[model samples]
Target: MVNFLQRFLVFLNIYSIFADGYSFNNDEHTENIHPFIKIGSKYYFINELLKMNWFESYNYCRSYGGELASVESHEELLALQNYILARKIESRFWFDGNDLAEEGKFVSHTTGRPLIFNKWSQNNPNNVNNEDCLEVNLYNKELLMNDINCNVENIAICKYREPNTHCSGKNSLMNQNEVCILRNLVESFAQVGHRCKSCSQAFMFPTS
Candidate 1:
């Protein structure tokens, strides 16, 4: 069992290294209308020409098999900031963080958890007139986050999670938890020599 698990982990890691530059064949709308730009490990879709309200922005990302970007770390934030600066996009953009569920408790709409990292603008998020959505203020050279009115139109920033394995078709976007579950199931059947055929094919495991 332990050896099987080790092999599974190694296989996923190896596949991920090769999947780094793999171009995903997405929907026609996503391919032509709003293509994602690879930055670091993740892919982001930002439309500077289009502006939408917080709800609209969230739905737009969902429609494209992504979520409103949740800036989880300083490094990720810096990369996004650099991209925006290079493009000279001097406009606010909606991210996944929001306090709409509860006042003063900012959470990521994507993860349903408290924001992991936030560089708030000085003396901001004052909830002035019921501001509930989180947006990055690129107009200000500082590129700080601010809680703003949900109805205010802003550029939509969508992000797809990094691909972890080379699994094709529906299994391609499986999350880590799903992978763990599948791995456990595979390990359970390994000793019996009855491993799942699809799983073996997806991970390139030896069938025999």
Candidate 2:
């Protein structure tokens, strides 16, 4: 396993250098460095600091039209990370790779190795606390496994396996969560009406 990781790392580095050149001198160039790759007809991107927990990773991915990465090898992991770095966006990101389902049996989406690159934050994976998910630090490119709590709000780098044309539509599933709010908005508009009269005559609800 170690030998495999070593070889994979070497190959990944070479690939990184080979595909690292780009020109961002203009807006067109700026938008050219997309941090994503199409593998097996599925699109994957780097987790650019998704400070989300385990379950959040699941839901967040769903909301974004993808699922947490199920990497199965070192090459794939490196490829995904390199794609992100190639963009020169941030230093690190997040991936949907974990094995909380069977604790201590750490697994990698890449290679499916029982013990792959398990670079955790200091005093991490203790599983002693709430942390169960993982995030790749953009600076040192290390992984930090953490727990998810709903109260904490962390911006996540979203990925999609397949691009949906409705992704940009305001009425798309992404915006469905706001359905109630949208209803309230429509209600408010109805109360105000198209041509407003005196407030006294506009809304004369019975005082109960």
Candidate 3:
């Protein structure tokens, strides 16, 4: 009798799902969660929270389907710098400038562009202590660039390889098979009261 009462309560809880009109979708959650900014022809993702060494930061950005941001123009660089400051991010951060491939001729492994638009500070790219990686600093009233040691830990800016801002997400039309499966699952759950909550990665927002 106790088991039967517990089962009846579970069924009531499941029925409440029908009263609330919303479906949980993992893909849709991911698609809407990134703090992506489209600048010119590219999208950039900046993170000031989890500072890492240049190599580690590079891999971190790569894991997110992008690399460090590559500046093609001074305007682009300025826009990014301004965006960073306006949000009150960390003072300095590592970016895409590096000459690991060939010393003195800095190039972005991410963008495949020679450092044609170098924004080096005066007497910069000094290669001091074999500094081959680049980091931009917004210390005091100075906005400058420096060639720093790759192992130095700092904030990171990640560039998105692709940005899809089309008509697709959770609200998009579902395929016939998917719709049928979802309907069947909904029906089964409605009859069973099996509430569930999936664990997800919890982290601070990378940007404002």
Please identify model 3 stretches exceeding 4 Å from their true place. Answer: 1-33, 39-41, 139-142, 163-208
**lDDT for each of the candidates?**
0.76, 0.48, 0.69
Q: Rank the candidates by TM-score, best first.
A: 1, 3, 2
What shift in Å separates residue 204 of candidate 1 from its native position after superposition?
26
RMSD of each: 8.2, 22.0, 16.5
Span of ten consecutive residues with least summed lDDT in model 1:
21-30
| Stronger candidate by TM-score (1 vs 2) | 1
| Clash tally, candidates in order | 0, 14, 0
Winner by lDDT? 1
Weakest ten-residue segment in model 3 by summed lDDT: 199-208
Residue by residue across 1-208, what tens digits does model 3's lDDT show? 3343455567657645632333345344435546756654557887766889999989988888888766767887788767777787765788887888888988877756786576778898899999999998875644568999999999888877643333323443332234443555456655543332222212211222
Ranking by lDDT: 1, 3, 2
Candidate 1 overall Cα lDDT vs. reference? 0.76
Where does candidate 2 stray beyond 4 Å?
Answer: 1-42, 45-54, 98-103, 106-124, 138-208
Q: Per-residue CA lDDT of candidate 1, range 47-81, in tens?
A: 88999999999999988878898876888888898
- How displaced is residue 168 in candidate 3, in Å? 24
Clashing pairs in 1: none
